[model samples]
Target: MKTSLPIFVRNSMYALRGGFLVRPLLISLALGLAGMILSSAEERFPVVSAWVPDALFPSHADPQVAQVMLSTIASSIMTVVSIVFAILLMTLTLASMQFSPRILVNFVRDHVTQWTLGVFLGTFLYCMAAMPAARSLPQPFAPVATVTGALALALASVMGLIYFIHHISRAVSVNHIVDRIARETERVIDELMPRKRGAVARGEDMEFEPEETEFAVLNVRSGYICFIDTTRLLKLAKAHKLRIRVLRPIGHFAPEGAPLFTVSHKSRLTAELDRDFRSAFGIGPMRTMQQDVEFGVLQIVDIALKAISPAVNDPSTAINCIDQLTSILIRWAERAPPATIFSDPPYVVRVILPWPDFKHLLDTAFEQIRHYSANDVAVSLRLLRAMDDLAATLNDDSMRKEVTLCGRRVVANCATRLDPTNLKRLEDRLASLEARSPSFATRGA
Candidate 1:
C-alpha cells in the first residue's frame, strides 16, 4: 500500500508538470487548426470564381450578400490571429523580464525593423492568397462565389495595410527604447538590493535605535541627501552613467556630523492618545560581520607590533620588520570579500608601500632610532603625522572601518605605546628611551 501511494503521488506530480508545459502549445495549435479548416472551406468554395468578370456577378443576387459572408470569415480569422500573436509576444516579453531584462530591453529597443518586416510579409502573403482578378466587363450571369473571393481579397488588403501602418509607428517611438532602459534598470536594482535576515521589506517605514551599531544615518543638504561625499558619488555616477535619483540607499554612510534618525516616543497632534503609546520602529541593519572580523584582526596586529623594537635593533632587523609588516598589511587588505569593505565606516587602509619607498622609510627611521635611541621627539612626531595622513585619507566611515580592521590584524601595540616586547610596538616607545637617558649619561662621564 505504501509503495502504491508513493507511485500515485509521483504520477500526480508528473501530470501537473506536463499539464503546465503542454496547455498553451495545445491551445495555440487548436486555434491554428481551426483557422486552417476555415481557410480550406473558403478555398473549396472560392467565392468570386477564378477570372470571372465582375459584370457576370448578377445585380439581382446582391453583391452585398457575398461580401458579408467573405468579410465575416476574414474578420474571424484576423481576430484569432491577432489574439494568438498577442499572447505569444506577451509570453516572450514576460520570460525575458524575469530572466534577462537587459536582453529584453535591447530586443524592444531594436524591434522597429523586425516589426516592419513582419508587416510587409503579412501584406505580401495576403496579396498572393487574395488572387485579385482583372476583368474588362461585368456579365449578367456572374456567380456569387466570384463576388465572395473579390470581397475577401479586398478585406485582406485593408488588414495588411493597417498592419503595415501600425508597424511603421513603432519607428517613431523607436520601439520604446528609453522606456525599456528604465524598466531594465529598475529590474536589476530590485534583484540586487539586500535581502538578508533583518532586511526591511518594501513600503515599510525604517525605525532605528540610538545605539544600534549597524544603523545608518542620512543628512540632506542643498537639496541633496549627502550620504557619503557628493563628489565621490557624482564621480561614480558619471562613470557608470546611472540615472538613479537616490534619496537614500543601503550601504552608504551619512556625512560627518550627521544626525541619526530614530523613532520618536511622542508627537504633538490635535488628538490625545494613551500615555503608554509607543512609536513603531524598524530598519535593516548594515552587514558588518566582515568589518567586525577585520577589526579584531587589526587589534591583533597592534598588539604584535608593540612588542618589537628598533632602538637596539640592527639595521637589517628594522628592514625585516618593515618588510614583514608590509606583507601582512597587503595580505589583509586584499582579502576583503565582496563590497563589504566599502559598505560601512571605520575604513582601514591595508596595503604595503612599494619596494624602494618602504625600504627607504625603514632605513630613515632606523637611522633616527640608532642615533637618538627611540627618544627623539621629532621622529615620534613624524611617525604620528604619517599615521594621521593615512587616517585622513580614510576620510569617511567606510574607508576608516576597512583600514582600522586591517590595522588591528597586522599591527600590534603595547599599553606603554611602544612595541611592548620590541620598542616599536607601543605608543610610548620614546618614553622608554627617556627613562634610560640618565643612566647612560652617568656611565659615559
Candidate 2:
C-alpha cells in the first residue's frame, strides 16, 4: 500500500485540478464557515450596533428585521443557484450536441464556470449560516453586521449571475473552444518537454540490455495509462539495483494481467516491489492532458471531424481547428520531448520508457482529418496550409519531410474523391509545401 501512495496522491491531484466539484465545494464551505464565525462573534460582542451608524440600519436592534432579511437573501440566492445550474446544464448539453462531446472536459475545467457556481452557492450558504443567529431569543439579539454582510453577498450574487450568463454565451463558441484546447496543448508541451531544442538529440533512442531472467509486471486492471511517475520509477530502480522498462506508453490501454513493465531481475522482485511498480502509473478510464499530448490533439481533431462530417459540413470550423492544431504543432516542434531513459548517475540507466515522437504526434493530429475531409476542397486546402506552416516552423529535416509527406497523403487521398478542379487546388497546396522543404525544392522547381 505504501507503494500505491504516490499514484493515489498524483491521481487525486489530477482529479482535483480538472474537476469542478472540489473548488466550488471548498469555496462554499469556507464562506459558510466564515459567515457562522462572524455572526457568532457579532452576537457575542455587538460590534455592529456599537460602531455602525443608525442610518445604515435603523432596525439594527430589531431581531425580526434581521431574520426577515437573512431569510429573503438565503431563499433568493438559492433561486439563483437553481437558475445557474439550469443554465449550466443546458449549455453543456448544447455544446455536446453542437460540438464534440469530448469538449465537455474543457467546459468543466473553465474556472469562470466553477467560480460562478461557487459564488452563487457560497452566497446561499453564507446567508443560511447567519440565519439562525438572527433569531429573537431571550433578548431580541440581532447581529447587524452579519445581516449587512448577507445583503452585500446577495448583491454580489446578482452581479455574478449576470457575468455568468455572459461567460457562458461566449464559452460555447467553436473558435473559443479550439483556441482553449490549443493553449492547453501548448502548456502541456512546455511542461513535458521543457528542454531547449538540441539539449537532447532529436532521435536518440535509449539503449539497455535486459537479462534473460527478466520478469513481467502485469497490470491489475484494465484502463488507460494516463500518467507515469518517472522519478519514482527511477528511484525504485536505483534502490533495487535493477533496470525497469515500461511496456506501455501513456494514453495506451493496459489490459488486466497484461505486462505493464518488465524488470531486469525477476529474483529480486517481491510483492511489495510489484505494488510499487504498479503504483508508479496512474490509470484511468480515459486519457487526460496531464501527460497525454495526443489527448489534446485528438480533442481538436474531434471538433474538426465533426465540422467536416456529412451531417455538419462546416468547413470553416474545420479550417479553424487546423489553424489551432498548427500552432500546437509549432510549439511541439520547437521543444525536445521528455527523455525516454532516466538515469540515477551519469551513464547508468535506471528506467527505460517509450514516448510518442513527432511523427506519431503529427499523424495523431491530422491523419483522421485527412481521411474525413478528402473531398472537401476548403478543408483539404487548409490542411495543406497547416502542414506547410508546420514545415516552416520545424528545423529538423526529417520532421519537415514528415509534414511534406502528410501533405502528399492529403493530396493523394483527395485525388480519388475530388474532381480535377478541386484536385488542382490540393496539388497546388502540396507543391507549395514541397517548395518549402529542402529535399523537395528541386521537385517544385
Best by TM-score: 2
lDDT by residue (38-149, candidate 2, tens digit) is 8999978875457766787788778899888888888888887887788788878988887888899888888988887888788888888988888776777888888778
On residues 1-445, what C-alpha lDDT tens digit does candidate 1 reach at each position? 4323433354344333333233434433443343334334444665524444657544424434444444455465456556645654675475443323323324433433343333333333332233222122372222344344445544654565466456534522312332343333333223332243224322112222232132222333212111122233333323332211232332234443454231122132112121111010011222111112222222222222332334233333233333333333332222322221111212221111111121232233223332332443333333333333333433234433433332222223222344435444433433322223332223122
- Give each model's whole-structure lDDT: 0.33, 0.85
The model with the greatest lDDT is 2
lDDT score for residue 181 of model 1: 36
- What's the distance in Å from true for residue 186, model 1? 1.6
- Candidate 1 runs further than 4 Å off: 1-39, 45-116, 129-179, 191-445
RMSD of 1: 24.4
